[model samples]
Target chain A: MMKRGSGFALSIMLLSALTLSACSNGEGAADGGGKKQTINFVHWRGEDTETFNSIISKFEQENPSINVDMTVFSSGDPYNNGLQAMLLSGEGADVFVSTPGSLFSTLLKSNAFEDLSGTPLLNSFSPDLIKSGQSDGKQYAIPYQLVYNVPVYNKTMLDKLGIQPPKDWDGFLAMCQKLKDEGITPILYGYDVSPGQLINTLVMNLMPEDDSFNKFQTGEVKATDPWFAEALTRFKELVDKGYILKNASGTKYEGALSLFAQQKGAILASGSYSMATIAKQNPAIELGLLAPITTSGSDAKYEGVHTTTFMLAVNAKSKHKEAAVQFAEFLAKPDIAAEYANATGQLLTVKDVKYDSKELIIQSEWMSKKTVFQPRLINTNKKIETALNESLNMIVGGASVEKTISTTQAEIDRNLTK
Target chain B: MKTRNGTLWLFIIPGLILYSFFFIIPAVSSLLLSLTNWDGMTYQFDWVGLKHYGDLARDPVFGKALGNNVKFSLTVIIFQFGLSLFFAILVMKNTKLNVVYRTIFFFPTVVSSVSIGFIWMFVYDPNIGSLNLLLNSLGLESLARSWLGEPSLAIYSIAFVQFWGHTGQVMIIFIAGLQSIPKDLYEVANIEGASRWNAFRYVTWPLLAPSATIVLAYTTIQSFKSFDLIIAMTDGGPNYASEILSTFMYHQAFTYFSFGYATAAAVVLMLIIMVVTYFQFRLLKADRVVY
Candidate 1:
């Protein structure tokens, strides 16, 4: 009888332990003492944590009725995966950052974010920038940072080779040939990383001015159109001509940057985000930016700019909706944007921010001039970008351009349900 | 006996409930989700029946990933098992040198797979890697090809790293099983004028069957579930040439936001693992072996 009683007690204890383990403490719940409401904010920029915290502190000082609990993920797929799980489980942050791509599209489609069309913050950003984050004519996210992708050449190397920065396709090809003849790698681009950038550059340069590429995204036209085929063929010609690095398919993005910094490569086809890192690696090297050259003999030059690099949105289901919106508004303030840009060396979409770095000034000047905004298709369909990247990789591996384009087109068509 | 049985049931009920809540329920839910057209973030989902499975059947990327997984499993079985058994046999006896060798061999097992992947990435780097430097120093420059970059060699390169990281664990299991074998059996074989090879072939081989089964099952499952190492090293890249099913499913679910399709891929992977493990149990069953 005693043993039986003991067994019953033990079972009860085990069950209690299991139950206790399943329970959470609810740390962020509203306090009954009438303290400031806590607004949970999550972002995938661990590199900007310190700067972001300082900005948050300033906001908290201004708005004493609100407290922000910020969580920073270390970036890449893990952040996206975790954010997806949290949003699905109805436990996501009140305010979160999203890229204006597949993730933003998913959030907008699900109505996960509050409609910010009437928000005062919306008026601060340009309509062109704000429209990129809208779905079905409703604003969902506010612009934060701007990133521009262009051809960065080593000014010192170009001067030594007696070649100026190219503005057209013939000059670009001639510079590449000259560099290659001098036993230098002409282009330091990694196919494994940021493969879509070069493809975007080529498409922007080669596509007909009729905006057929945009129409293709809406399913009005196919990717196997003559314009796309021509772009693929031209890209393959560069690969076949050995203008791109011999082991580019294998080279990583960081590896290519290191090569450029070491003066092993004359030109790096990358974005403004790399400027800070490049300067840190080789401060002595002078860098110059040029628009991606056109092969169609068109006199017009086109530079690609990403107006919405990382934007903040308010969660529709957040309990502290007012506080979350206030925090987002604080982030869009011009002073905060300037402080963020100064601390992180990133370009902001906020109006009238001062640039201390000459490199940023040069990039901003290019941005203020002739530029083609990145297409909505590249942002909307991640599968298309991945397919294009993989196709480029295969082309570098000696696959035929026609087969690569067809396979990529098929992949895109199959995955275009959205 | 009835009271004892009741106590046993009481003890097991808590574990059973936890398992049902965490594992079985989620797994069954995922199976149900596989038939839907959910993008994970959306509130609305449509039941699409077996459409996702149909798509998987036609997916060339899925085919490539499965083939890579099979190759990865086979290579892990051969190299991890073979090297571990050899090392176990070498160090089974209690000796100082053997202890040192055991410690050295087992060191990598303590390191996380992410760290191991990063280490191997540097080792396989084409320009500045130690492997290429060694090849150049040995006057074998022609043999110094990109290890993780080439389409044909990337999977094998990753497999070698997996083998290096896990062989120590298998060796330790083999050592435990070796120690459990009765010394009298070896004495008896020697008394009968049997050679060392004969003794090992007849006695050690049969006794180690259980250990080999454990090692094989573990290595097989590990090979199929490989993600972090591949992600950290090549990210299943060089044109998805080295993409396994886990990475493919990850891209679908996280990158493409196709939760339904990703779950279908998960279900297929689970079925593959179940079928393979079932066969392994049958083939390596110890019931027929005599002590």
Candidate 2:
């Protein structure tokens, strides 16, 4: 009898413990339809994220049925580095943005993102934009927000020097000489190699001004073609002329921005993102976006266009797929697009949505003419930037432009294939 | 004593379990991971056996990174050890300003590393930084260069900042070691007519070796693992001049999403550290001091 009683008590205790454990595991996971839904969004957008945050609020108010759990990632490498590791470990966000090149290609091949094909969201977005999001015509992510890298100059300085925006490469050099002769630094450059402030600077300087972004991505022309080399050489000549700050070779991206913002330097080769944010922060200085100087003459066949696509893709493994899709649909609505565009000072990606900012409207017009989204970095060519950085560093170290450019061509040729 | 003997293992068991779960399991898994080409996503992996190790030999960037790591470790090991020893001795010299000197020297170590990186970045600012401003103001314009931006000087520039920040830790450790050394040994040396340098050489130096060894091993490991300084100051840039193995692993795993290859790189680092541990234990093994 005593043994029977003790055995029964032990069984009861074990049952109670299992119940407790099961309840803890099952809590908050069970949800019936029509209840409030929560979506997790993560990105590396930093303090410039205010515009994004306001847009999120507008989203929540309009669709009170959904709640967004936004996580702003720390800036620098950790933002992107740990993102997928978290995803693969089943711990990352439900919806996140990724760069649209080799990283995206690699992720898509791994079957990391949910298919958006033939969905309501798919029909709503531009097919060309989706094509840009895909490899050989399969969609993995959507264009989040498109931006273009352009050259920005100090308007007050330009006016003082009575310089009209240079329509040709020679005129640009003469203007740089004028700025230098006056003891004002001609260019605020941070040659801090690779993905430094160089991204927009070099691209704007080099990209052919005449081709569609689509043609460039589709390989109608090559990045190493003479048009790019001419641009590259012209950009390097500014360095040789000592128009760019000497310390720029060592400058990091942020270092150059802060320097430019302080009005210590005149010419800045950067992005549209720089335009909106710098305008807000540096109230003491006036900024004007101009046609970036190019290697080709004014009548050159190509004009560099600056446009970027930021996508928000749902993680496939999440159980909240329905909710995630619904939230994505909400994001695609014209109203949602307006909120995002207005907040970011970005031109919206949705066709039906009206461009909000004047800058956005201008950029949209430019994108229609001659802009190529920088080639989505090929996976095999992922290390291409390292070569770019090394070459840039070599140039600043006083290496011959001929040697640097040829060596870069050699590296890309050797490595961009398996 | 009885309770200690009885409950020591019992007390240690929880920590041991946690350590095994968190550190040991992950470490073992890293070794397993090193053999595969899993991109840190999904359960799928391609077993490459020793390919990653072989690839390490062919990887020029990895070679550059490894060389950088070794140079950083050596530079930190020497200066960190030297300044720490110098400060420890200075503070222990029974002088009037010793305490104040010790406090000032140790202040940098207490601040965060990211802050150190930022502060140094400003100091090296080329356009309008105080370092250059001061230099130029003093008519030393020729001496001003972007200290952190230059390819040849960036590595040293970063290491010096680290030395300023971490030398305090070594100094504090040495101070403890110095405090424990009996005055009687010094008294005997004084009676024997040995000079100050001679006393340090014969008496103080041998006693400080254990502490020095501990500091050396610690700083060596830390210097090899130095990331925040490089990340914040340069992000291992200006043509990969300041790139270290850890940063390279970081790029592969975090930035480039080649985490499987990155894990392989980490495994190499772990092996190097294990070798270093063995080397330190062999070299620093000393008889126990009774005093």
| lDDT tens readout by residue for model 1, B170-249 | 89999998998999999999999999999988888888888878888998999999998998888888878789999999
Could you tell me how far off, in angstroms, the CA of residue B11 lies in candidate 1 after the best superposition?
3.8
- Candidate 2 CAPRI assessment class: medium
Q: What is the alpha-carbon lDDT of model 1 when measured against the actual structure? A: 0.80
Q: Which TM-score values does chain B get in all models?
A: 0.95, 0.90
Top candidate (lDDT): 1
**lDDT by residue for model 1 (A373-401), tens:** 66534446777657766767877777898
lDDT of 2 by residue, A25-113 (tens): 21233244545556677777766477667767877787666667777777446766656665776644677777665556666766778
Candidate number of the best DockQ:
1
lDDT for every model? 0.80, 0.71
Error of 1 at A6 (Å): 17
What pairs collide in candidate 1?
Answer: none
